[model samples]
Target chain A: MSLLNDLTGAPPGLPPHALLLRLAAIGAVLAGTTCGFAYVGGWLSPGALTPARVIDRFEQVNGPHPGFRRNHAKGLCVEGRFAASGAGAALSKAGLFAAGRVTPVAGRLALAGGQPYAADAEATVRSLALRFTLPDGEEWRTGMNDIPVFPVRTPEAFYEQLLAAKPDLATGKPDPARLNGFFAAHPESAKAAALIKARTVTAGFADSTYRSLNAFRLVAADGRDTPVRFAFVPERAPSPETAGQAVQQDKNYLFDALAAELRQDALRWHLVATLGRPGDPTADATQPWPADRETADLGTLALTGSTPEAPGNCRDVNFDPLVLPLGIAPSDDPLLSARSAAYSQSFTRRAGEDKTPSAVAGAPPHGAAL
Target chain B: MTPSPRFNLPARLLHWSMAALILAMLLIGVAMVTSLADYHALVSLHRPLGILILVLALLRLANRRRHAPPPLPADLPMWQRRAAHASHVALYALMLAMPLVGWAMLSAARYPVALAGPLVLPPILPQSPVLYAGLRSVHTVLAYALFGLILAHLGAALLHALIRQDGVFSSMAPWRPRRAAPTLRPEG
Candidate 1:
C-alpha cells in the first residue's frame, strides 16, 4: 500500500496488522507535534518579558542603590505589635486573629518610586507594608497604599506605565509627550489621577487611611467563603491644624511630625473588611466596590511605639501579598500575583546586591520613620 | 452515471460558517494581545465567538461521520494524498482542542468561563497559576499551528481550482452543478 493509504487509516484492502501499525504512527506524530509546539512556545520563543526584566527597566531609568527597592525605596522602619481581636474568627480562621494574640509586627512606611531620598513633601503615593509573624512560624504580609484604586489592572500595563514614567535622560524630567500618550491609551488610570487631584492630603502617616486595594478570600471553619477587601482607617481625628494646609517646605516634615505625635499618644487604625456582593468587580483592583457593600470591623491596629532609625527586623523582609496564613487566599485579581512576582524579583536582585560589599553602610538607619 | 462531486448541504454550510468565524477569531486574538486599548472589547467578542466555533466544529464532526466525504482524485500523487489526509486530521484536532484549552486555561486561572452575562460555564480544571501558565502557552502554540494549517488548506483549494481544474475544489464549494460534467479530468 502507498503512504497515502497508511496515513488515511489504512485504506481498503490493507492487512489488519498494517492498519494497527499505521494508527500507532499517526498517534506518535500528533504527540510529537504537540510536544514540539509546547517547547517552542514555553522556552524557545523570545516573547513575554520576565518580571525581572521589567524591574530592570525601572532601575535603568532610576539609578539603582545598594539597598533600595525598585519601587517604594525611601522608607522608615517601625517596630510595633498588631493585636488581633477574635472578632475576625467568624469571617476567617487565620491564626493571627485568635483573639487578643499580639504579634510583633515589623513595618515600613515609604514613598512610591525608586528614589531613596525623594522629598517627603512631593506629590507621591505613600505605602504602608507590614509583616505579622505567628507563633507557629506562619507569616501574613501585606503592602497597602493610601490610594483607593490602583492605576492599572494587570502587570503588563504596570510595566508599560513604568516605561512611560521614566524621565528622559537628557532633560532629567519625565517627558510629558510620553505620559500624555499613556494616559490617553490607558484611560482606566484617569480614575487614580482624579482621586489624587480631588482628595485633601493628610497631615501625617498616623492619620492617613491605607487600603489593600486588592480583594482576598476569607474561608470560615464551616468551609463557607466570602470575598473581602481590607482598609486601615485611622481612629484619630484628622488634625484640624494640618488638614488642607499648604505643602510643608521641610524635606523631612512628615516623618518628624509622626515621631512627635507617636511620643505623645499611641496611633491606632480600625481594620475594616468590606464584603463583596455578587457582580462586584473583584478581578480588577482598578475598580472600587459599590458604596453600599456590606462591611465588618475586623479589629484595631495600635502602633504603640516608634523607632528613631530603620528597624533591622523588617529590612530584609518582602511583604508579598500572597504570603497568607490559613483560611485566607488570594482572589482572582491578577494584580495580586503580579505584585508577588515583581516583589520576589526585587527581593532576589537586592539580596544579590547585598552579597557584594559596597562602600554604602551595611544598614542605613531605616530612613527616618517613627 | 456517477453522482455530481460535492459535500452535503449541511457540511457545506458548516464549512463556510466556521471558516469565517475562525478567521475573525484569529484576528481578534492577535489584536487583544497587541493593543491594550481594545483588549477589553475584543475579549468580549472573543469569548462568545470561541463557543460558536466549538459548536460548529462539533456539528461538522458529527456530519462527517454520518456522510462520507467525496473521495480524492484517483490520479493524485501518493505523497500529495498523504499530505492532504494528514492535514485534515490535524485541522480537526486543532478545531476541537482550541476552545477546550482556552476554557481550561481560564478555569486554571480561577476566572469565570462566561459566554455572556449570566451564562457562565463551570470550571473544568482546578485553580493553579502553574497549570494556567502551561495551558496558556499550549493554547498560543496550538493557535499558531492551526493558523498555518488553515492557510495551507486555502492554498490547496485554490491550486485545485486554478491550476488543476479538479473536482476537489468544488467538492465543498457552496454551488455545485446538478449533473457531472461530460469532459471530466481523470485521476492520473
Candidate 2:
C-alpha cells in the first residue's frame, strides 16, 4: 500500500514539481480574487469618477432634500402633444416627424437649481424636459435647457465647476478666486459662461427657447445618419414683464406663471432641428453650430395642462437624455453617457427617499386630467 | 461512528457544477460593477445567471438532504468538525440569500427581472427607494461574505488534500484517487 501511494504521488509528501504546480495554482487564484475584490471595492482604480461619486458630489454641494431630484428639484409636470410636420421626414424617419402624426407627451418645466423653493428671480436657467411615448411604445426622452450652449464640455469639468461654485463657509457665496481659477483652467467654460451671460433670461418658461445642448444623430431609412441639434422655439414672444422685476413677488413665480398659462390656454413651441455640416462639432456641446446651418421645423408641441409632480406623475421618471427612439441615436459626446449615469443615480436615490407631495398649489393631483 | 467512504455521485456532481457556477457568478458580479462599457451585456448575463444559481442552490439543498456527505475522519478535532459544518451551512445560506436579495432589490427599484425575451418575474416587493437601497447594500455585503467563505473553503480543501493527505478531500472530489487510504495520518 505504501509503495502504491508513493507511485501515485499522494500528498503529505508531494514531489517537488507537483508541489510547485499546486502552490502556483493556489497563488494564482488568490491573486485573481484579490484583484477582483480590489476592483469591485474601488481600490484598484483610484480617482476614477463613477456615477455614485458624481451623485455624491451633487448632494454635497446642494445638500440632500430627500425625495426630490438632486437638481431641477422645483418643477411642475405638463401634458402635451407633438404635431409632426412631414417636412422633418426628409431629414429622418422618426415617426414623431411624420405628417400630422401626434404623439402624447408628459413634460416638466423648471428653473435650474437644487432648491425646490428658490425665488424665481434667482434662477437664470430654465429647463424643459419631455417624454414622448411613441405609437409602438418606445419612448423618446429629452431634457433641454434655455441656454444656447452648455456651460461645460465634459462631466469632469462640470464637477470641477461644482466644487469651485460651492458656498464658502466664511461667506455664503462661492469664492471668487476659486471660480476665477476654474474659468482660467477651462477656457471653454469661460467662453460659454460669457455667452450665457450675454443672452437675456426669458421672462418665463413659456417664451424661453429650450435647446438640446448635446448633438444627436437622425437615422434615415438607408442607414445614413445626420448629426443634428434641436431646440423648442416658443411661439409666444417674451412677456412684457421682465423676469427679475415681475416675478420677484412670488417665490414660485416661474411655476405659478407656467401653471396659470396652461390653465388659460395651451402653450406651444416649434421643434426646430439644425442640420450639422461635416466640420461641425458633434461631441462638444459648448461649441455651437454656425448660425447659417439649415434649420428644419419638425413640428409643434402644444402643452394642454399642468399637474403637480407626484408618484405616478412625471416625478417618477428620470428623463434620461439617452433614452432615444429607433430613429435617433446619441452622439459620441462623453457628456451623454455621463449625464445618463448621473441621472440614473439621482433617480435611484430620490426613488428611495420619503415621498414628498408636490408643493404646487391648486394644481390637479397626479392623473387628474393631465 | 464510521461513515460511508465517499460522497454519492449526485452530491459530487452538484458540488462541482455549483463550484463552477459560483466562481463565474462572482467574477461576473465584480465585472458588472466595474465596467460601464460592457454594463448592458454583463447585466443580461447577470440576471439570468443569478436565477440559475438560485434554482441550482435549491436543487443542491434538496440533494444534500437526501444524501448525507461522507463523514470526516474520526480522529479529526471536534472544533474542526463543528467549523466545517458551520461553514457549509453559511455557504448554503448565502447561496440562497444572494439571488433572492438581488431579485428583491431590482423589484424594489421597479426594474423588471427579465428571464428571457418578454418573460419577466413579478415584483417580490413594492417599489420603495429606501427598501431598494437597503437591499442593495445587503447584496453587496453578502457578496463579499460569500467570496470570503469560498476562499476559506478552498483553503481548507487544499489543506486536507495536500497537508493532511486524508480521505476528506477525496470524498467529494470528482475523480477517485489511485490508492484508497482511509486515513494517511491517524494524528490528523
Candidate 3:
C-alpha cells in the first residue's frame, strides 16, 4: 500500500488532498502526450493515405528495383540547351522566355512503369523530365509525359488506381475486373484512357510531344499571373512506321532508336504554352482546355547528346514538378504537390539503394560535349 | 559562490524562446511528413528553424556552463532528482542531436540545406544511401523520445508549482507565482 501510495501519491511534504489534483493533472499530461504521439506517429488516423504510403505501394507493386525511380525506372539521360523564342515574354517575365536567352538543361527520357528492365513494347506512356538551370542559380524542373491528360484528378484517386493496377501473382498482370471497376468508378480516367488510345504512338521519343498535364501560373514582371499548360512539341515529324507497328524484337528498342537519332544530329522541341481562361480548371489534370486556347512559343529545347541512366548528369536529380523559378508558380493543380512529394520520397529511397547500371546500350559517357 | 535563486536572464530568455521554437519544430516536422499541400512551405520554414534551434542550443549550453541553474528543492526525492537530471541531459542531447542528425540525413541523401536566399549549408557528411536511411530512422525515433521527455518535464514542473509550492517552477518560469514566498530556500 505504501509503495502504491509512493507511486500515485503526492510527495511527503504535500497535503493528502493535493494527491487527487496532482493525479488528475498528471493524467491529463499523460493523455495529452499520448494523443500527441498518436498524431505525430500517424496512429490517430488509421489507413490515412500519405506520400510515404503511396511510394511504398509503388515498391510493393514494382518489387523493389534498387537505385531506380519508383516510377519511370527505365530511362536514358540527355544534355542540351533551351533557347528562348522571345514570344513567351508577353505571357510571362520568366528569363527562360526572354528572346535569345539560352540555359543549360539536363534531362531524362523514360517509360512510365516502375520496371527498369521492362520491354520497350510494354511501355504505352513515355516521359521526359528536364531541369533547366538559369543564369541566376535558380532552377525550373518539369516532368512531362506523352499523355494529353493525367488519368486521375487527386492523389487519393491516383492511389486507388495504383492499387487497382497492382499485378496479380498468378497472371503477373493487373486483374481485369479490378481495373474495370476502377475505370467505372472514375469516369475521368476512362475518358483519359480513351483519348490516349485514340492518339497514334510516335515512331520514337524524338518525334513525341511531351505535355505538362498539370496547369501552372506564369508570373509576369508586373505581378500578373497567367494560368497555362505547356508542352514540348517535337520538331521531327512522326515516321511512317508508328511505334506500335514497329515494336522491334529488341527489349530496349525505344532507347536504342533515341540514341541512334541523337548520334545523327541534335533533336529539337518547341516549348508551347497553352494559356487558360478564367473559368478553366486549374485543379484537375484530367481535364484539358478547349483546343482553341491561345498558345505562346516559349522556347526550343535542343537535345545535343545522350548518356546512360546511372552515371548520367540527371541521375541524382529528383525532377520535382513544383521546383519552379521565381517567375513561375504552380497552379491549384492538386497533382503538382502530390507529384513533388512522391518524387522526393522516390529520390530518398533510390539514393539509399545500390544503383544498377542502366541496360541502355551505346550511350556517350557522363560529360561528353553537348 | 552561492547560485542565484532564479535562472539568469539569459538562461530564462533562452529557455522560453527555445521552448517555443522546439514545439514549433516538432509540429512542423510532423506536418511535413504527413501533409503534401503544406510540405513545400513547411520545408522552407523547417530548414531555417532547425538551424536556429541548433545555434540557440549551442549558445544555451555555453551559458549553462558559465552559470549553473538554481538547485532543486531539498524535499524532492532522490529518484526524482536523478530523473530530473537524466531527463535534462536527454533533452539537451536531443536539442543538439536532432538538427545535426536531420542535417546529416539530408547530406547523405545529397540534399541542399538551403537556409535563406543565397545561403545554403554545406553537407556535413558524404552522400551515402545506407547512412541516410539509418540516420533518418534515428532522427524520427529521437523526436518521439523528445516529445515524451517534454511531457514528463511539464508534468514535474506542474507538480512543483501547484502541489509542492517549492519555488522550483518559479526559478525558470517567465513570471513569478504570487504564492512563491521569497524566503523559500533550496532546502524546502
Candidate 4:
C-alpha cells in the first residue's frame, strides 16, 4: 500500500496531458480566441468588456473612420454610410482596412432537434452563423442554415409553426401526426423540408443551417439594387458518414475546426448580392432571387489577432436595413419588413432577458419545446 | 488512550486533489459572476463540478470517521489543537455549502443542468428570483470565506514548519515518519 501510495503522490496533480490541456485552455481564454469551458465564449470579465476596445479593433481592421466616434464615456457611436458611399471601396482608400478578406470568422454549427429539446444533441440540418468585424469598426452579422429555404416566412408564422411543432402538453413531445400535418400544411417550406429530409441528421445543436430568409440588397460597386440571398456554406462539406456523430468528450468540434482552418488557410467568401439581371426577379428572399446561380465575389477577410465576437466591432455595430445608407437600402418585401421587425424584437428580447439570470434563451419557439 | 491510524492513502489523495480544484474553481467563479455575457456556460460548468466536489468531500469525511487519522503530537498545546480542528471543520462545511447553494441558485434562475455530456440534471429546487439572488450572494460570500480558511491553513502550516518547529506540518504532509527523520530535540 505504501509503495502504491508513494507512486501516486509523487505525481500529485491532474494527468500530464490533462494539465497540458488546462494550460492550453487558460492560454486561449486569456488570448480571447477559444471559448474555454463555456459553450459560448467571448469576453471573460466585465471590465474586459469595454466598447472602446471593440471600436478600436474594428478601426484597426477596416481602417480609420472619422465618422466613428468614441466619446470616452457614452459607449460607442458610429454614423452610417450608404453601401454606395463606395467612399473607400478599396483597401488603400480605407485607412485601417483588411481589404476584402474574411480571415477571422467563428462558426457555430448546430442541429434542429424536434422534441423536449433540453439537451445539445438529437437533430440535424447544420445551422451556421458568423459575424465579421472590419478594421473601420464596421460590423456585419451573417446567419445561415444548411437548407436554402426555411419553414416559415413571417416571424408570426414562425411562432405559430414552432408552437404547433412543439411537444404535446401531455406527452411532452411532438405528436408525429401533428408534426406531419404541420409540415404538409406548410408546403411553402418544401425546399427546406426536402433538403432536411434527405440530409443525414446529426447532433441537434451541432448540425443545422440558419438562413436570412428576407431579401437583402447587395450595394455593388455600381450601386445596383438587386435582391440577393446569403448563406454560410460549410468551407468544406464534411463526409455524409460524419453526419449525426458527436465525438466522444468533444464539446466543440465546429469551433476547433474553424480555428485550425483560420490558422492554416486564408478564409474567403462570395459577397454576391442579387444581380437583379434583366431576367432575374427583384430581391424577395421569400420568393427566391429569380434563378441566378449564387455568384462569388472573392472578398478576403482575415482575423488579424483578436476574435471579432459579440459586442465586439461586428456585434456592437447595428446592421439593420432600417439603418442602411442611401446606396444599399433594404428591398421592399413584406417578409423583409417582417424580418426587420422580428429581428428587432429578438434583439430587444435577447438584450432585455440578458439582464436577468432567469431570462435564459432556453424558452419556447427557439429552444426548449413548450 | 489509543491513537487513531493515519488516513488511508486513497482518502488523503482525494482530499488534497479536491482542495486544489476548489481553490482554482473559487478564483474562476469570482471572475465569472461579474462577466454576465458568457455566464451561462461558466455557471453550467461550475455547477456539476461543484456537486462532484461536494460528493467527494462528503465521502472523504465518512471515510475519515470510519478510519480515523493518526494522532497529533503529545506535546501540542490545547489552543493549537483547537485551531487546527476548527479550521478543518470550516473547510468541510464550506465544501458542502457552496455547491448546494449554486444548485439552488440555478434552479431559481430556471437554468437546466447538462451533466457530463448529454445527461440533463434535474432541477432540485424550484424557481424563485428572490431565492436565486440570495443564494448567489451566499455562494459568493462562502467562496471568500473558503479562501480565507485556505489562507489560514497555509499560514499555520508554514508557522509550524518555520517558527514553532512543531508536528502540525505532518498532518497532511505526504511523508510518513521514518526512524532517521530529524526532530527538534531540545538543546542540552
Best by lDDT: 3
- TM of each candidate vs. truth: 0.56, 0.75, 0.88, 0.38
Better of 2 and 3 by TM-score: 3
lDDT of 2 by residue, A1-370 (tens): 3453343334435556766666567667777877876777567786877777777888888887888888888888999899998778876767888898999999998767676766665345889999997754356889999998998998889888888988787997889999999999999999998888777676778888999999999987677899999999999886534645653466777777788888889999999999999989998998888999998899999999998876666787778886666678788877887787677678877876787665565444347666
DockQ of every predicted complex = 0.02, 0.15, 0.40, 0.02
Interface root-mean-square deviation, candidate 3: 3.4
Ranking of models by lDDT: 3, 2, 1, 4
lDDT of 1 by residue, B40-146 (tens): 45666877899888898999999999887887877677888999999999999999899999988766654455565335577788755556657777887998888
lDDT of 1 by residue, A298-320 (tens): 77777765553232335556677
Model 1: DockQ vs. true structure: 0.02
Error of 3 at A291 (Å): 1.8
Candidate 3 on B38-117: residue-level lDDT in tens? 67777779889999999999999999999999998775678989999999999999999999999998777656676765
Quote the chain B TM-score of every prediction: 0.93, 0.94, 0.95, 0.84
Model 2, position B124, has a per-residue lDDT of 93
lDDT of 2 at B52: 92
For candidate 3 chain A, which ten residues in a row score worst on lDDT? A1-10
DockQ of 4: 0.02
lDDT string for model 4 (A64-112, tens) is 3232221111111111211212222431222212243333343323333
lDDT of 1 at A31: 56
User: Any idea what lDDT model 2 has?
Assistant: 0.80
Kindly report, for each predicted structure in the order presented, the TM-score of its chain A compared with the true chain A: 0.81, 0.90, 0.90, 0.51
**Which candidate, 2 or 4, has the higher DockQ?**
2
